[model samples]
Target: MGKFDDLPETRRKGLEKMEEVYGFDMSDGEGDFFRYTADHLFADIWNRPGLSNRDRRLFLIGMLVGQRANDVLGIQVPAALKNGELDEDALRELVILACHYDGWPNGSRMNAVVEDAIGKAKRAAGS
Candidate 1:
């Protein structure tokens, strides 16, 4: 199989979605990791059958909150809202739930990122 031949059209669609949703650019860098990100992470894993993209975003948000991955959340949180996978209230509730599990600090920091993401999403939406 070629670079994305394992999943073929699915891989292409996944790449397009990644670009559309996250503005990811695998070809911009010089690393096998980017290729793997495109061919496997986005193509294979993201296209997997069970969860919808909305579910994936929710899981990602929780994981990011738990891990305090503010940088990734800066991208994903807005994408979630922009793509209609999440709304403001639901995002707040999810962060609150994560706070219960991860502790107050994580929730607090993630909430900042959430606010920033929501602001950017709104600006992009021109509202």
Candidate 2:
């Protein structure tokens, strides 16, 4: 059997939700960090119904920019675009808004990241 075959139902749901959010399979992730990310973060927190995925994504983008988490942003921005959670214009606007509150330096970095993600997403989509 596969390593994840015996995972609990919550883990399974988390994997599914991760795939949906990131637009890619997550079942191959291993180790405790991956497990908790799937089980706790994805399944429990992300699956909560109070906010839509887009809402959470916007919030996360702001937080990432504020934290200068460009590495994570590199992953999330692309996923948000691929999932149709946010479009190029919306992401551009978000960079302005988030940077306005966060800071100019962070905004500049985020703008570059956002543009790179847009280029990659467009290339991937053949757009």
Candidate 3:
């Protein structure tokens, strides 16, 4: 069986969700990093039973903010909207909450990334 074939149902779903969010493609021959991300990070970690997808998304947002991972958030914020994990208002609240923990500079950086992501999503949506 292939690696994909060996995936648990939840892991397969997690991989699908990851692709929807990040446009993550395994067929691009990107490298080991992408493979590991798809197989291990999304499959193994994200698929872990206990947390719902919504709970995972919330945790992701917090970790991204704490890490100042604005580039990752560029994809995540839009995904949150598309996946119905977060609406615009919830996104705004996330920024506000992030500011309290991450401070102004990082928060502003996150805001900029969110704005850029929102613009990208809007254009994709024909607005």
Most accurate candidate by TM-score: 2
lDDT of 3 at 45: 74
Q: Where is model 2 poorest over a 10-residue stretch in terms of lDDT?
A: 1-10
Candidate 1 — worst ten consecutive residues by lDDT sum? 21-30
Candidate 3 segments whose C-alpha is farther than 4 A from its true place: 1-17, 20-31
TM-score of 2: 0.89
**Cα lDDT computed for each candidate against the true fold:** 0.77, 0.88, 0.73
Candidate 2 Cα misplacement greater than 4 A, ranges = 1-6
User: How high a TM-score does candidate 1 get?
Assistant: 0.80
lDDT string for model 2 (8-96, tens) is 88888788888888887666478999888999999899999999999999889888888889999998999999999999999999889
For each candidate in turn, the TM-score is: 0.80, 0.89, 0.75
- Strongest candidate by lDDT: 2
User: Candidate 1's C-alpha lDDT?
Assistant: 0.77
The alpha-carbon deviation from the true structure for residue 50 of candidate 2, after best TM-score superposition, in angstroms, is 0.6
